[model samples]
Target: MAAENIEQENSKVKYLRDKLEKAILEKCPDSRLNGDKENRLPNTTNISFEYIEGEAILLMLDKYGICASSGS
Candidate 1:
């Protein structure tokens, strides 16, 4: 069902977001990021590293073999 697929996708996104958040916090501590921003996508995260260009995040994603959307 369409709804089931959506739910599955959402679950995967949620899991990825959780893992990503923990990793980011640990590996990039003191990276000058937004302290209290929230995830606008259903189950994805958007973090803004203050000193890093946003495009740089794309390079990291590419390094990780992830194909993600850039928010509007």
Candidate 2:
């Protein structure tokens, strides 16, 4: 795809990322990614507040008009 298309896609991605991040930060303040410096993905995430029901967070974004991948 062209840069414009890519930028547009990123726009949507950013919105979802923002929402998810805000929710996670506020709702799960204890969660933090676990790893050394080399194991992390840039602009990526891997956090858990030991949340058992939090997997549904991915689905929550869809209800808010944002589409997102589940980092799979």
Candidate 3:
């Protein structure tokens, strides 16, 4: 039962992550998702935007209470 619940929760997270990725790509055509599409952690997303400073993006997201990490 516990394993089933964990699997279900993981599926939900993966679905949401895919949706978010689609939205991000739609809004920012210059952005690209990093890492493997099918073999990545269900809860994490890494996206690289062309011509944007990572720190600046992080600061803007922070203003809206969004927590994000950058590798730049």
Candidate 4:
């Protein structure tokens, strides 16, 4: 059961990441993805929006119930 649960969660994370990546690339072209997509943790993503402050992004994401770190 534990292994199955892990697989399920990984699937969800992959889906979310793919969606987020597409959305950002299409709607926010100025934004940047921090690491190599082919060589990163399954459940971790880092994006840097151009010409924006980290705190501002954090606050907006927080309002939408998305928890993120600034990596400061």
Model 3, span 1-72: residue lDDT tens: 878699889999999999999999999999999889999889999999999999999999999998998963
lDDT of 1 by residue, 1-72 (tens): 878699788878877877877798778865533334454564655555656666777788889998755454
- For residues 21-60, could you state the per-residue lDDT of candidate 4 as single tens digits? 8898789978878779787767788888888898998899
Ten-residue stretch with the least lDDT total in model 2: 33-42
Candidate 4: residue 29 lDDT (0-100): 79
Pairs with backbone N, CA or C atoms under 3 Å apart (clashes), candidate 2:
none
Runs off by more than 4 Å, candidate 1:
31-39, 67-71
Ranking 1 against 3 by TM-score, winner: 3
TM value for model 3 = 0.91
Give candidate 4 misplaced runs (Cα > 4 Å). Answer: none
Clashing pairs in 4: none
List the RMSD of every prediction in angstroms. 3.7, 5.6, 1.7, 1.7
Q: List residue ranges in candidate 3 displaced over 4 A.
A: 1-4
Listed in order, each prediction's TM-score against the native is 0.54, 0.44, 0.91, 0.81
What does the lDDT read for residue 60 in candidate 4? Answer: 96
- Winning model by TM-score: 3
**Where does candidate 4 have its weakest 10-residue lDDT segment?**
37-46
Better of 2 and 4 by lDDT: 4
